[model samples]
Target: MEFSASKRIIHGFAPAFALLLLGSLAAAQSPKKSDYLENIALCNGPGHTSLAARIGGCTAFIDSGQGTKTALAIAYNNRGNAHTINGDVDRALLDFDKSIKLDPTYAKAFNNRGGAYLRKGEYDLALQALDEAIRLKPNYGRAFVNRAGVFLKKHEYDRAARDYDEAIRLEPNLEAAWSGRCWTRAIIGSLQAALEDCNKVLQSWPNDAATYDSRGLIHLKIGEAAAAIDDFSAALRVDPKLASAFYGRGLAKLRSGDKAGGDADISAAKAIQSGVDDDFVRYGVRADN
Candidate 1:
């Protein structure tokens, strides 16, 4: 199984805001001013899932020439996020860059930029941006979680666990933190703890294939091959494309003396990802059955 890092940004790159000049009396006095205020309101509203509207609103507001540097930065960042939601990371990065230029200490912008870098698999750059985010806002639990993901990719399991701990302390309901910590615990031989963590996460996300795969590994670690096989089967039911689940179930099948099933599963897993056998062998699992 694989522990996922933050696949997407949680919030916007700028803080929420509102303009206070909109009233019926003022709207009656000047149509131009009313349009400006209306546009600004639309720009400042949450830009999620309405990319075209957000872009148009933010553009109109930015053209209105009525906002401070910080306000303009927020507008630009909002538009950038709309671009990000629309699958345009290049535009998102440009807006994030502009947002940071306007307000260098904007921790949200840095964090968003880090997430963009992480999506690109540039781990070192992601860490640098995330470190800056934490430095600017020490209580940013999201940034801590992102950094911990980088640590996990680096195979620094202890550091990943520590960051996950800090993230969980800062935000108790952070599911990603629990999932990452569970994976780290499993790799470190803390099987029972990992099982508990996986179970807790599964309560909220019962159909999560990755968590099921993780729990299966925990069961296998504890010599409960039947239980592990069941968990792995559940994982595959949820996500038939999950190569790790197939590999894991193969191991459990072999442990339970189902030789033909084990061989078929291992072959299927290797078909999905070449060299998965060598990787599992390197992971020290009993893949030589």
Candidate 2:
């Protein structure tokens, strides 16, 4: 379960939150043409699976061109991030190791390497990497959030909650931190607290389909069928491509005696992706499609 939580944190880093941060940064820095070239070079991944190869290729280009050490570091770091996203923990760690070797004080490289360790279930290694990141940059809210997620996985609920509290105090607008708090609360059986954290996340990101899905799960836990259905429906409305919303809503519908609707939702979920868990089909609720 702890490992699962860590996986969730690494695989789903709240894209909306990252996008929002990027938007804010865009206004402050009009990067040069060289920056654009560097970005393209860093984006040289092939099919997203062999990120290590892509990193090597990008670094080769950086070496050939009189690209600065910063550009090479960025390439290594971005490749490591891609490898981490692709679940190649060892390769991700290697790339991050290279990035840090090039720029020893690179906080992001340490933080990302920590995430790779977290995914590999190397809790102590993850902590060490995150500790280095924090030492390098004291205001790194992301490291705090990741560390808190590690604690949550360990079921050290008090410590997890404290870390989450500190992270939120440091960065009030980090949606992932709020979502992490929600997941932690849910695990600890504090459904109300979990729901509250979900609500806060949704307030900042109303179109976030996952938030609605999570809130629906909380409602289902609390036996609020109608509320759960509403959340599931909202999630589907936001992102029609999501199979989980249909499955969740189907379960709610099944609970409410809407067999036809429930069946349709289940079918829709299966149509989108045939691999949805049978448990999801059996237990999920929704209105007739």
Candidate 3:
């Protein structure tokens, strides 16, 4: 019942909305028109996620009547964001294409389309989309973040870290950017720095199961068996169905002289979904290897 590792990894990282080369894919408030426009400007202006929701609502409003070509382009761009948030990459790409058809200079749309391409494993297309995005918006941090993901997939950790660093400089408290940096660092064996970024993410929004799962990996790396177990257990506490946490804690238990417990946990993980990934196996304790 071992499913493809790639698929399981995709499933594990599903909630995070980060795309790997082989892989991947929030909130509300009401307001007046001026307030909405202001929020949209801030969201889109800063490349915050709120832009997706705000643009979606604005596009719906524009479609009612008095919609100009420019207005329709904006609507398409915004709707593309909504689609992306909902994991409708195909729809997102179509909306982006429409936005560009209406306004050839829609940089954000290009960036988002590049994101869609990345999710589909079309690296060249992703790079092209991101390049256009950067060309259109020289100071766009989101484009840099997206491009960094491509680099991470390609195993160009240093390049990815550089992009993540630039993104951080552009937007200090951007949680996604920070998490991307943390992940890149973790891949490159910089567990301490990765832990710092994880801490920052927790500070902004604590109790993230993924964050805990990731931190557990870091702890395992640094040889903190007991600490790793605690983190994995906490991750399971937050989200019981996280198969990786079970596998992780199982490995930790096995490594720390609890073989029976480890076997039981791995059995539990396989039961949850008998599929397992080799890369996931790589993440297990050294003894597991």
The model with the greatest TM-score is 1
RMSD in Å for all candidates = 3.8, 8.4, 9.5
- lDDT of candidate 2 vs native? 0.69
* TM agreement with the true structure for every prediction: 0.81, 0.65, 0.73
Give the runs in model 3 whose Cα sits over 4 Å from its true position: 1-65, 267-277, 281-289
- lDDT for model 1 comes to 0.77
- Residue-by-residue lDDT tens digits, candidate 2, 1-289: 1124333454212121112222223422545445544434444453443655555555554454434556556566777777777667798788788888988988888888888888887888888988898899888888888888677556577777777778798888887778777756755668898899999988888886777887887787677889989999998888787787787788788888888998898789889877665434233322332
Model 3, 221-284: lDDT tens per residue? 7878899899889878887877777877887898899999988887888778655434464333
Against the true structure, whose lDDT is highest?
Answer: 1
Provide the overall lDDT of each model, using Cα atoms, as 2-decimal numbers: 0.77, 0.69, 0.66
- Local lDDT at 39 for model 3: 35
Q: What's the count of clashing pairs in each model shown?
A: 0, 12, 2
Runs with alpha carbons beyond 4 Å of true place in candidate 1: 6-15, 19-67, 79-87, 278-283
Superior by lDDT: candidate 1 or candidate 2: 1
- Report how far residue 109 has shifted in candidate 1, in Å: 1.2
Better of 2 and 3 by lDDT: 2
Off by over 4 Å in 2: 1-61, 65-71, 86-89, 120-124, 236-251, 258-289
